[model samples]
Target: MSSSPAKPTSQHTSDHFRFHRPLAHLSGPFGNDSFALRAEAFARFFGTPLFLGAQTLIVVLWVGCNMAGLVHFDLYPFILLNLAFSLQSAYAAPLILLAQTRQAARDKAHADADAQHREALAVANETRLAAAALNSQQMLTLLQQNTELTEMTRQLTERIERLTVEMHERFVIHGSAP
Candidate 1:
């Protein structure tokens, strides 16, 4: 239940084992809640196939328009288009890096949580096993005690029966019959 993983001890030995695989939480740092999350979302959008297709289409249109002489915006050297791509890369790099940093933080948090969970489980299992061992030992001791008590009771019963028979014989020998 603690926020961090517990260290292994001699009593709780299962803590030495690892059984959990922590997965990344990709809930996006900038969701609908804040601008930071939104910016991260927009930054990640560029990595998708949809963004690739859209960019390819725009490039084709730009080339076709220039070759057909329909637009004089970006001529032979395509200086304006090249400048636009440079500008896009300049902004894209940092935004993508920011989102990546957020993702890394989320992953670390998830990993820490999962480690704590595994520690709890291992401790529970070790406790159960220890309890079972103690119960087994107590049961054996009880059985042994029971056997000794039963033997003692039998001996006492046989002694009582012998004493009763002897007393009866002595009474018959020393007194008149009824």
Candidate 2:
């Protein structure tokens, strides 16, 4: 059985940003390739506690091993360790900058979309207000027409009663006097 996708309700449709067409492209800065994705992930991991802790542990072990004479790969100056740190910084600075640039672009896109959504809402509210005002005026006019009709009916009823009394006096009282 082929099932169609469920239709979005008003709640889902009202999310202007979620359905915004322009911001869809801005959702990812790194092109979908594995390398670009990996680079972005690596940049994100740089400031994490896990990354910092692992690096600290490795550095301590390296220094401890060298000082204790258990490994003499790079001795007093720790020149090799310093070189490794330099290489890491070289790669890290650019990747971090790239991530920051991507984030800035996404932020700008969201901000623009939000501004457009607000404008649309304001226009809709104004239209609704104008329609409500027009409806109120129409209702007022109908109430006035009803009031005028009721007054005319009351006057007609009073005039009929007066005419019936005058006719009764002319026929009954005049005929009795004769």
The parts of candidate 1 lying over 4 Å away from their true place are 1-33, 171-178
Leading candidate by TM-score: 2
Instruction: Assess every candidate by TM-score.
Output: 0.74, 0.81
Clashing pairs in 2: none
Question: With candidate 2 superimposed using the best TM-score fit, by how many Å does residue 167's alpha carbon deviate from the native?
Answer: 3.6
The sequence of per-residue lDDT tens digits that candidate 1 reaches over residues 41-136 is 679798999999999999889988998999888887888889989999998998888778877877777778777887998999999999999999
Report the number of the highest-lDDT candidate: 2
Per-residue lDDT for 1-178 in model 2, tens only? 9999999998666753454776776655676678888888899899999999999999999999999999999897999999999999999999999889989988887888889888998999999999999999999999999999999999999999999988889889776543
Alpha carbon lDDT of each predicted model: 0.81, 0.89
Model 1 RMSD in Å is 10.4
Backbone clash count, each prediction separately: 2, 0
Point out where model 2 deviates above 4 Å. Answer: 1-17, 171-178
